[model samples]
Target: MKAGREKARGAWQLSLPLMLMITAASVGPGVARADAQDLPIPCANFEITYAAKPGEVIAPTDIETNKDSFWVFENSGGNLACGGTGPFTCAGLTVTVPEKDVVHPSTAKTTINGTAAALGEQDQFSLTSIDANDVTQTCKGTYLFHVSSNGGGWGDPHLTTVDGLHYDFQSAGEFTALRDDRLEIQTRQTAVPTAKIPITNEHTGIKHCVAVYTALATRVGSSRVTLQPNPNVEESRKGMELRVNGKLVTLTDSGITLKASSGEQGASIGPAAVGGIDGHIKKAADGAIEIVDARGTQVVVTPQFWNGPNVWYLNLKVYQTSATQGTMGIVPEGSWIPALPDGSSLGPKPESIDERYEQLYEKFADAWRVTDATSLFDYASGTNTATFTLDEWPYNSPESCDVPGQTPVQPTTEAVAQAACAAVQDPKEKADCVFDVMITGHEGFGKSYQIMQAFKPIGTGTWYSPEARPTKPPTHQGGWVELLKKWWWLILLLIVGLLLLLRKKK
Candidate 1:
């Protein structure tokens, strides 16, 4: 390869501009750029060190609010590229609207100020990479930035709804997370015993507690799947509880097609078959089952194991086209979304959590609570959604220290818990991680946050950017893509030689 490149160096006098464009289609900035520099060229291996998935992004932050340089660098790979290095030369960037529906462009009028270009068009906003793990480059494909910035809190339950509304409602019940005309998501929230987890500040004399989601159900284009906990099963058991339509099914690998099981046919829920949902009943490599409907509703449920039983927590990362109505859709205390019962809007957000509680719990939580008609859960012969609701529930979570007249208290092992969550980067996530560890005295909870940071957040179009890009660090990629990159100059040399041979024959 070195000899070939050395040989091509002499022929470099030809059209070099077109060559770079032909070979620049790669993932991220780690791949060093190629260029013809001074005298005899020294040996250089151009490999993609950092590669972000096609439309992968995390932060919904825009160029203006974020003063960060190099907002988004889109390149028509194969048309031209190269920025992670090699003589760094290229054409320009193109902004693509990921899909239909969902607002376009993150900001009202995106006017990028950096050397990078201003966001040209809309549907999908061009914004900064939210996730710290994303590798910025001038040639990586389109970065995700929902104008309404759709995705929000799977925050273990400190809900951040559609329009970025933040609040908490820990009522133990099966509630609607999201409900559109066709797409639907339901979560089973179970209150944690104060004795089990100490979310209340140390012995502050308040029976403070919180709830975590134990199961999640989704109906996407004629498919209904429930991810729930396997009760009475030992912790050693390693598998997910997946109920397709109404009957339970065991999965060995990723994808599965559901057929009418005994008693599932003609049941209350729709038909018993998995109707062409992409990745239906498919288990992700990380032990989570991911399901997506044709019309852009997506659900990824990660299994959680702790003191009680091995339950699961789900995160919905979509803002549908239709009027989304449910817990996840309602933006409480914020004027962004039409949250009021009368089809009006909630004004600016209040400062304190208690103030939010007064609004979120009273208005949205109760308003969106699932009824017998709207309820989508499997019930025992004698029980129903009422089993989860409180006979006389309070305004705010009783476990919250934010309750008026009650002073907040920190756990006795605050230091230890903080230390456990020290590795988590995001401030809010870190704080939550520390508290979870301190309250439960279980380090596993905090570790989960650390693991999630690596996940490429799901964005518009219900398309997922694979969390791990290179799978193996930019090590020796033996595939043809790498082969071409390594011997590109050699290939060019042969082409030039062939051209010369044709000219001589002529």
Candidate 2:
């Protein structure tokens, strides 16, 4: 009896720990681990000093230094420079010239540290000077300089004098090494006491001008750099051209505007004029340009450019929540008619559809592609009474759905269904037709099914599927499999309790 009691005690002790572990696992806090790539890389800060030519010194009052002004750069493999060697090349140094200053208006410069570093063809750098009258003059040149390991020393000078003002700029800064292939250098004016530079505007004939200037630099390729005026301080004007992916896009005071390749006015997207409405454009994950308007309308434009004899056209797909309210019709290449303020057309009447059945079928197919049941139903007639089966249909082969280089299989069954609808003789009967469509190849499965649906014409060019307009609640299929799936946990608990009871009896 003593030995049996000891054995039972041991079994209970082991089961307690196991049960505790299971309980803990089921009820413990859930913490999600983030991907290493998603974590931000840490960065270090450093100070920088600048030396200006004797007469080109800035004022001390305008100079402000803080944590925000510190240069930020990423380190590559724990090295200060990208390649982890001596003499790294920094490119694309953009300088912003302050307004109300008679001295330096704006300047851009590039610096090379190593002798082997070469500038690429795309690198652009320049310096501009504005006189008392606001007249502007620019000089283009390259500046080469170096700093010691301790961040002290003035290197060679690239000097330029414009309108009796001697302009010379030199820089020295401490480099902070980072984990990624990047480094940050912070530099302040050493010789100059302040940040404000006094200048005269030659264009406006204004004197005693104190202008503000800001500078930033970005590395390009291995050695080449292109510099420009600071965009934060300068306001984007009506005619500013922004180069995006080798194409020149215009920026206006209102918003960004895109022009067609044929020089025609394209789409102008900006903040919505209506209250409680907003509109914006963004790049999609698939590399398509998507524009969303205030009314919840979306227009997706493909990156593929269609170059014609005169202009370039982009493939566009427009979507709206309401089919009747926001319907888009395809217009011919050059048949755009300007509408007057009083609702009068200024050009030829709208083109008439010769193949009405084909047009209706296309609309139906489009609605099906997007899984818009309401829109699909709106294309049928009111009197036609039939049930329509709404289910997922594979429009492409599994191998070619997302794979490159393979053409996707089209939904030929939809075409076959449309052709059957078009074969009706009487116009009235054709407008109100019934179709039994059988579709196969769903998600690469060869399963085929049929759906009996009736369509009726609501208006001259409008049709709707009557199956969607049900007067009563639809019936649903239910069985033991579904009930077991929902209550599986209860059955599992019962089995566990039974096993524990049997073990205790033993």
Candidate 3:
């Protein structure tokens, strides 16, 4: 209405002589008087053109883009222009979103006055110039989201990632676990400093700190779900509370379901059934919540009990599409901007644990850390990420120790840990559990590692045949040796044949 009134008001401002001149000129070949204003406005049909610039660089086909913001449609160039360049204007440029698109401003009616506004798998829209006599111009386009196919977990008390990369992030704060165009996961870690109780590691003397997730939140489309510790703290420790979009939700025998709007459901949450919500869900063995979005993105928010700290911290297992882009997702393949001091690429993978730690913990970790503007986790009335983010690690190295409130870790020897973790099925996990148990000096934590080993991810979410990445690294040991051992007789026959040939020649 404002744009129409502005155009009408301008049309009336025309002088009598000028109006007459326009009318006389309009009698020519094809020009016409347009509009129902007090005075006729001379113009022709309004025209619109599409441009990718001044907005997201759309995919070659205008379907895939990795952004959480809406797409922008530029119109200052030609959209709603009368006579191609006439003094015509339009406003209240609205867009029609398909139900499949769970876009922000998740409303049916969306307005994008040219240089602003966009959404979803596909959109159909129509708008007219401000002139009351102008015809409505219709437009339509399709967009399919691209996603990341790889995801991994951030283990409590023990930092781990998909790259088989591990480190100790002993900082208490919320960090962006994963984020993509359509999904996001965030974690709240609590740091445990070794300044209380007896030394946990008798061998190392225990001076370092470790962090663990205490709260986890995820956003798929517009449905935000959070699993955090129950406020009612007890010596026995109550389980976690699940909230959807800030409203506390309870789990039924069949679990809970949430949607972006009143349309088709956007996500389904349920208990860890024998088969999992039709295999779309991946429930944690410890009864953590498993969520599946329409796009088949899987998220498992789990809590682990830390006997050493006598606290329960959370962990995250994310299986995003190829479109995933956060630190926990399939990030860039070890490409660091500031080259090594000698000016060389960091190679495709880290060569050593220190190199990997520097890349993941220092460089890549900082790259994806959330700021106030981009953070998706809901904060309490008076707190934020900054409130929790501090010098979480203040103690010096164990080389020289000053004891304070170090938590007591159960004593466990290497043999004991191996035997405890022997029940774990996966050899890799068994080794890892044994290693971790030795480090923490507690056999109980072996259960945590066992659960970690069994963390079944929703591999390549929804991908019937995913793109081929590098093959798995060669096994720690084996390859030809095992094959040869199984075929010793065959080898012996070849050796005997060679000896017979040599004897015949002699």
For every model shown, the clashing-pair count is: 14, 53, 17
Could you say which candidate leads in TM-score? Answer: 1
TM-score of each: 0.51, 0.17, 0.49
Q: In candidate 3, what are the lDDT values of residues 44-87, reduced to their tens digit?
A: 21211222112233221112211222223324533322222211
State the lDDT of candidate 1 residue by residue for 1-506, as single tens digits.
56555545545545465466436734333211211110111111111111121233422221221212223323333312233322221112222212211133223222211122111111122222221224442322222212223433443365656554554555566777775534578887765443343443321122236657777777654557777655535632565467777687877673664332333222211222332222245565456555654323345565556544334444334432232456656554535333644446657656566665555555656666777787666664676778767532332444342323333323438889888888889776677677666765566666566655545534432332222122223322256666666777787777787657544544
Error of model 1, residue 431, in angstroms:
1.7
RMSD of 3: 29.3
Candidate 2 segments whose C-alpha is farther than 4 A from its true place: 1-286, 289-299, 303-315, 319-343, 348-478, 499-506
Assess each prediction's global lDDT (C-alpha) against the native: 0.46, 0.23, 0.44
Worst 10 residues of 2 by lDDT: 148-157
lDDT of 1: 0.46
Badly placed stretches (over 4 Å) of model 3 are 1-148, 154-170, 194-208, 261-285, 331-366, 392-411, 452-506
Taking the tens digit of each residue's C-alpha lDDT, what string does model 2 give over 64-118?
1111111112223232322222223322222221233334322211122212111
- Number of the predicted model whose lDDT against the real structure is largest: 1
